[model samples]
Target chain A: MSKVTTAANQFAARRGFNQIANRLFTGIVWLIGICTIVFICGLLFLILKKGLPELDWSFLYGLPSEMEEGGGIGPLIFNSFYVLVISLVISIPLGMAAGIYLAEFAPATKFIAFIRICVEGLASVPSIIFGLFGIALFVEALDIGLTIIGGAVSLAFLNLPVLTRVTEESIKAVPKELKHASFALGSTHLQTIRRVLIPVALNGIITGICLTAGRAFGESAVIILTAGVSSSGEMWDFSLYSPGATLAVHLWYVQSEAIVPDAQLIAEKSAAVLVFVVLLINIVFRVPLWLNERKTR
Target chain B: MQSVASQTLIDIHKLNLYYGQFHALKDVTMDIPEKAITAFIGPSGCGKSTLLRTLNRMNDMIPGTRIEGKVAIGGADIYSKEVDVETLRKKVGMVFQQPNPFPKSIYDNIAYGPRLHGIRGKQKLDEIVETSLRSAALWDEVKDYLKRSALSFSGGQQQRLCIARAIAVNPDILLMDEATSALDPISTLKIEELAQELKDKYTIVMVTHNMHQAARVSNQTVFFLNGEVVEFAETEKLFSNPRDQRTEDYISGRFG
Candidate 1:
């Protein structure tokens, strides 16, 4: 009877220990989740608190005045959008074609493997290196002399590897049975890709485009080297050969070397706008995916 | 029980297939008749599905796959230099074991093949979608929800939708590669019933693991073993009195 009582006591103790351990794990998981939420919230709060007061309409639309106290980011904003459009126009078709070739047509030869490795390596290379290369090739060799086209081309190079990888992965993820069904229905390879593959992988392709757009919007190094630190005098000057400064590059210039007295305020407001636009781009892309999920349900 | 009125549509003359070093199909020669259901039965890795894929050259997509001898459809050599593979495939449509509808609206899913073949008018697409869905017996279920995604349908409905997608192209042949294996019993029965009706308009070939399914739905059954055709006979005769000892043993549940 004494031995039975001892055994029962041990079992109860083990059960209590398991309960404590489970509770500890649960607490740790919750703590990690809460920490991430708090960190993001804190960063957003800091940016808004410092930037909201200075973000007036004039500061957004009026031209930047070097000698004046209050200067606007109109040219910077226009140039940012200009450079983004140019880069996306150059990258999307070329990247998607390369991606399709890699995913569908490229054989399993050693040469193909080598190309894949090179693509991955290029993806990991720093943006700064691409910026330097852009200066050498577009600004110096091509004699473009800090033109918007030069900057845009450099940004396209930076976005290409990422877009290609995303496209290949998304295309590869499409079910092989779908391809088989298309081929069985007397569709050629090109027709099948155009009708079935592209539509199915459209979500991933959009995500890739959004990601590259966001990166190009916030990039400073490539723009500074290839597009220069000043825009044309006109607010909406869209000449490809004109010097341009994107928003991120303008922010850096305002913080480091602006002649205006309210440079710090301008920088803070620019940072806030940058963060907000990126967030908006993410939400815009996610809407379609969310609707797709809801409709299937 | 062999039907005398059926005419030969596909003739295989000493066909051999290889996947790199592996001899997947050997000396496979048979005459598949038109406007009838011909079922291929075998154990796993028995080359039944491979032969079905060969009917439409679907195996051409796989790397390192090689074929020898000849396959003729309606007295035309399919592998000849003059024959375009795309046109040949248009003559032969296929359904997979898993229902693989494009992730699109129900109407778009059926209209994909028609559109690829360059049918563009709104009125024409609408008519084709309606008729094809009706042919697959899924019109009433999905008629109101034509704008909804095809994936929203139940598994059985999706399989039928896939059939509708295939039939929209008006192919002369339909190949089903174990098309009902992933479905429930009710869905399987529904597909089997649909196959029976489809054979009146198109030549039907199916690969099935279930012996009873072969016996129940197929008019002619081909039994395959070790990448070779072991027996080819009428479904009734093959099941009741299999000529080969291997066919008899396999049908009697002796061995695969």
Candidate 2:
């Protein structure tokens, strides 16, 4: 009876060890997942706490004035939209075409592999370096003054590598069967891409575009060096040659001790607008994904 | 006794297909008759699907693959430099083993091929979609929800939609590669019936592993083994009185 009891105790101890180990493994994974969610929500809460109260028609629509306490981000907002649209116009087609080449058209070879590595490396390069490049080429060499076009072109170069990678990934995510099915029906490769591949990957592409737009909208270093400090007179001017200040640059400029008397107010208001615009763009981007989910189900 | 040009719609003469260095198809030679369901039955990896794809020059899509023999459709060598691959494909359509309907509205799925082939205007496309769906035996089930996405359909309906899409272009030949092998018995029978009806207007070259399905739907059957055609004859004769012992063994369920 004593021998039997000793064996049972040993078995129980072993089982207990395994149970603890299994629980610990599961607990660690769960902790990681919860922490990620908590971190994201915490960051958003912090930004909103500091930024949301500054949202008002006066702060949003009123023109900037030296005497005014909370003038407006109207010019900055307009400039941001302008720069974003232009940059996307330059980047989307070129990046998407390059992405298509990499994902679908590039023949497997050493040169193609080298080009792919370069693209990945370019994506990791600093944004400030892009600003420097822009100042050197567009501002100095090209003699394009500190204008919206110059800023937009700079941002396009910065965003192209990321945009192309995302587009390629999304395009590649579409099942090969879909392309094969289209080809079997006699569609040319170009036709298949135009009709089936693009439409199917539209959500992913739009998501990438929104992310790029958000990055462009919040960009400070590139806009500061390339586009300059302020718009030329009119807030609603549609001219690309005019100097522009995007939301992020406006925040940075206002937060600085120089020039702005109401630095805190200006920073808070600009930050609020920036948060709102980013969220809005993201929501708009997700609409296609929602529709796709509904359609597939 | 008849010349291949007169009776056959798709003529394959010494058709050799090589995938890189490995010979995938070895001197495959056969003729597919016009307006008939011709089934290619063989063990897996016997180049049955390869032969079906060759009729429409679909093997051109694969890289590093080359063909050493000629495949002619309607007396024109499809491999010729003068051949317009797009036009040839429009004339000869295909349906795959898995049901692959475009992730679009049921109407759009049917009208896509026709629209690409230059049929414009909503009314014409609507008519074509409706008629093609009807021909594929899917009209009654899908008439009310033409605007709904095709993914909502059952597997069988999706396959039928694919068939409708293939036929919408008004192709002279329809190539089906084990199209209904994924469907249930009831769905398989329905597709077989649709195949029978389609043969009146189009030539069908189907590949199937099911001996019963081959016997039931096809008029002519070609038996393939080890990348070569073992026996070719009328479907009934091939099943009941196969000249090749390999064909007999396969048909009798001895082994593939």
lDDT of each: 0.91, 0.87
> Candidate 1 chain B, which ten residues in sequence have the lowest lDDT sum?
B1-10
Per-prediction DockQ: 0.62, 0.51
Per-residue lDDT tens digits for candidate 2, residues B127-238, read 9998999999999999999989998888899999999999998899999999999999889999999999998899999999888899999888998887899999988899
Candidate 2 similarity to native, TM-score:
0.92
TM-score per prediction, in order, is: 0.95, 0.92
Question: Judged by DockQ, which candidate is best?
Answer: 1
Give the CAPRI rating of model 1. Answer: medium
Q: Candidate 2 lDDT, tens digit per residue, A13-97?
A: 4557888999899999999999999999888787878878757786777677655466677888888889988998999999999
Model 1: per-residue lDDT, tens digit, B111-166? 98888888999999999999999999999999999999988889999999999999
The C-alpha stretches of model 1 lying farther than 4 A from their native spots are: A1-23, A286-297
Best candidate according to lDDT: 1
Q: Alpha-carbon error at B194 in model 1, in Å?
A: 1.3
